[model samples]
Target: MSLRCALQLGIPDVINSHGKPMTLSELVAALPVHPTKTHHLYRLMRLLVHLGFFAMQKVADNHFQEGYLLTPASLLLLQDNPSISRPFVDLVLDPILIETNNCMSTWFQNDDPNPFVTVFGEPIWEHASHEASVNHLINRTKASDSSLIGRAVLVKCKGVFQGLNSLVDVAGGTGNMAKAIVDAFPDLKCTVLDLPHVVADLQGSKNLNFLGGDMFKAVPPADAILLKWTLHDWPDEECAKILKNCKEAITRNGKQQGGKVIIIDMVMGNQTWDSDDDKITEAQLLFDMEMMVCGIGKERNEKEWAKLFFDAGFSNYKINPVLGPRALIEVYP
Candidate 1:
C-alpha cells in the first residue's frame, strides 16, 4: 500500500515539480497533510526510497539538505504517461476488492458465483454498475491497460494493423483502444463496440466511432477485430461463444479474404525462450486466482487455448508472446 500512499499524496508529481531533491521538511510543508504527519511522511518516504520508487541523495553538511528524488519506476506512475497505471493501482487496492479477498475460503465452501458476490450479494460487475466509484475504477483501469498495450502494439508490432482497411474493438470501453489504434493508422476505419452505459456521451474522431451493442449478441464487421484484455473475464463456454460470434463477424465483414480476430490476454504458463522468468509465472498464477475469486474466468495455457480455438471452429492461430505475460493471439476462421 506504500505505492498507493505515494500516489495519494502526489509525492512523485511534487518531487518532479521541485526539480531538485526535496528534503523531508520541504516535502512535509508542501504536502496537503496535517502538521502532525510530517514525521510520518518521512518514514513513508524512507520506505518508498528503499522500494526503488524514489532515490535518496545525501547533501553536504552545511550547503543543502539530504532529500528524496523520483526514480524511473516512479516516473511511470506519474499521471502524465499515456499508460499510467495509477487508476489501476487505485482499483486493485480499493476497499471493495480488498474486502473480497477475505471471503475466498468461504466462497469455495459455498455456491456463490464469486467471493465478491458472497461479500456484497452480487457479482463484481453488478456491484460496479451501482457504485459510481466502482464503475469509474473499472473503466479507468481498463483505459490505462489499453493505453499501455496500444502503445506497445504501435511501437513493437505495427504489422498487425498493416493492410487492414477497417478494425473493430469489441468491448472497447470509452474508445481508448480504438482511438489509439485509429490515431496510429490514420487510414483505418476504427469502431468501438461496448455497452451503451460505458460508451454513451463519448466523442469520437474522424476515423474512430462508437457502437453500443453486446458482444454476446454480435460484433460489428471489420477487416480485423481487436479484443484487448477482453476474453479473460469469461468462462470457457462463454469464450467459445464469443469467439464463434467474432468469427462470423470477420467472415461477414471481410468476405473475400476472411479477416482475423486479435486477442490480448494472458496465456498462462507461457515459457518461451525470453519469458521464462519465475516472477512472471507467479504473477500469472496469481492472476488466475484473482479470476477465480471474481468467478469470471481463468487464465489458459497454450493447450487450453488451442482447445478453445478449435472448439470455436478456428482453422489456424498464432501466438505472439511479445507483451510480457500477456500474448497477442491471432485466430483465423
Candidate 2:
C-alpha cells in the first residue's frame, strides 16, 4: 500500500527531478497538496522508508531536518528513466486489475475462466479491447517492459538475430522489441504481428512493418521469429499449438534456409548461481504465483522448457543464460 501511495504521489519522479535529496519541506512544497497536510507527507515518507522505497537521513538539528532519497527500487519508478517501470506499477495497481484480486475466491467457486473475468465480465484481452483506458494501460506497461528487455537483448543476445535476413515479433506490443532489433541490425527487415486494434494507429519504418493477425492461425514468413515474454501467458497445450504454427511457418519458407525461433522468457532454476540472494528467488516465486492467479502460465525450468520445444517438433535447441531470471532460447527446426 505504501508503494502504491508513493506511485500515486509521484514521489520517485519528484525526488529524481530534484537532482538531490529532498527535505520534507521541499517535498511538501513540490506536491500539489494542502499546506495543512505537511505532517501527513512525513508520515507517508516514514512508511515508504520502512518499506525500502526511500532512504531518509537527518541533515540538520531541526524538527523537519530529514531528507529523503530514492533507493534502487524507487529509481525504477522515475518516469523519465529510459527503463522506467512506472507504467507497469500503475497498470497492476489500476482499479480494474486490482478488483480481480477481490474476486479470486468467487472465481474459485464458480466456473469462470479467471478472476479477471469474474470481476470485469471478460478476459484480459477482451477487456483491453473494449475499454480504451485499460488498453492504454496495458500498452504503456508493455512498452516500458520492452524498453528494459530491449537493452538486455541487444547487449547479451545479439547473436540470436545475427544472420537473419528478416524477422517477425509475434504479439509484439507497440513494437519496442522490434524497434530495438531494427536499430541494431539495420540490414534486417523486422515486422511486428499483433491484433489489428493494437497496430491500428501505429506507424512503421522503412524496414519495419506492422501486420495484424492471430498467432494461432498464421504468422508471416521470416528467417527468424521472436517471441519475447509471449508464450508464458498460455497453457502448455496452447503454447504447443502456437509453437507448431511457428514451426510450420519456418518449414514452409524452407527449413534448410537457416530458420529458427528465438524465445525470451523466465526459466526457473536458471539462476542457481544467484541463490545466495534469497530476495531474487523470492521475487521469482512471487511472479510465479502472480501468473497462476492472473493467467494460465507459470515460469518453467530448463527441462520443462525443453520438453515444450521437443513436443513442438523442434529437433534441437540451446539456452543461453543472459537475462537475470530469463534466458535467450534458440529453437531450431
Candidate 3:
C-alpha cells in the first residue's frame, strides 16, 4: 500500500516537476505533510528506493548530499503521463477489493462464485453496475492499463492490423485501445463494443465509433475482433460463448475468408525466462489467484486455450509470446 500512499500524496508528480533530484527537506516543504512526520516520509522513501520505485542520487560531489529521483518504474506513475497506471494501482488497492481476501476461506466452504461475491452478495461486475463510483473506478483502471498495453501492442505487433479494413474491440473501456489503433491505422475503421452504461456518454469520430452491446450475445461484424485482457475476466464457458459470438460476427457479411480474432491475455508458462528470477511467472500466478478471489476466471495454459478455441469453431490459431507475462493470440475461423 506504500505505492498507493505515494500516489495519493502525488510524490511522483512532485519529483517530476522538480526537474532534478529532490532533496529530503525540499520534498517535505513541497508536500502537505506535517513537519513532525518528515522522518516518517524519509522512512517511506527509503523503503521505496529499496523497492526500485525511486533512486537516491548525489546532489553534489558529496555522498552525504543525496536526493531522491524518480526511477523508470515511477516515471509511468506520474499523474500527467498518458500511459500512467495509477488508476490500476488504485483499483487493486481499493478497500473493497482488499477486503475480499479475508473472505476467501469462507468462500471455499460455500457455493459462491468468488470471495467478492461471498462478501457483497453479487459478482463484482453486477455490483459495479449498481454503484456509480465503483463502476467509474473499474473503467478508469481498464482505460489506464489499456493506454500502456495498446502502445505495446502497436509497437510489437503492428502487422496484426496491417490488412484489416475494420475491427472491433470487445469490452473496450472508454475506447483507449481502439483510439490508439485508429490513430495508428487511420484507414481502418475501429469500433468499441461495451455495455450500454459504459459507452452511453462516449463520443466517436468518423473512423472510430462506440457500440453498446453484450459480447456473449453478439459482436459487431469486422475484419478482426480485438480482445485485450478481456477473456481473463470470464470463465471458460463464458469465454467460449464470447469467442463463438466473435466467430459469428467475423463470418457474417461475407467476411469469413480473411477474418480473425486477436486476443491479448496471459498464457500460463508461455513466457521465456532468461534466469531464475521468474518475475513473470510470479506475476501470472498472482494474477490467477487474484482472478479466483475477484471473479470466476483463471489463467489458461496453451492446451486449455486450444480447447476453448476449437470448441468455439476456430480452425487455426497462433500464439505470440512477446508481451511479458501475456501473449497475443490470433484465432481464425
Q: Pick the candidate with the highest TM-score.
A: 3
- Specify the poorest-scoring 10-residue window by lDDT in model 3: 269-278
List where candidate 3 sits over 4 angstroms from the true fold: 61-63
lDDT of 3 by residue, 6-34 (tens): 98998999999998879999899899898
Clash pairs, model 2 backbone: none
Q: How close to the true structure is residue 174 of candidate 3, measured as C-alpha lDDT? A: 97
Q: Which candidate is the best by lDDT?
A: 3
State the weakest 10-residue window (summed lDDT) of model 2. Answer: 272-281
lDDT of 1 by residue, 1-333 (tens): 999998998999998888888888888888898877777887888889888999988755535568788888898789787889888789878888889998889988998888988999988877776787888889999988888888887787788888899988998998777878888889999999988777888888789998888999998888888888878889999999899888888898855356899998888877644545676788789888988887688889999999999999988899998887788998888
TM-score of each: 0.93, 0.92, 0.97
Ranking, TM-score, top scorer first: 3, 1, 2
Q: lDDT per model, in order?
A: 0.85, 0.84, 0.92
330: Cα error in model 2, Å = 1.4
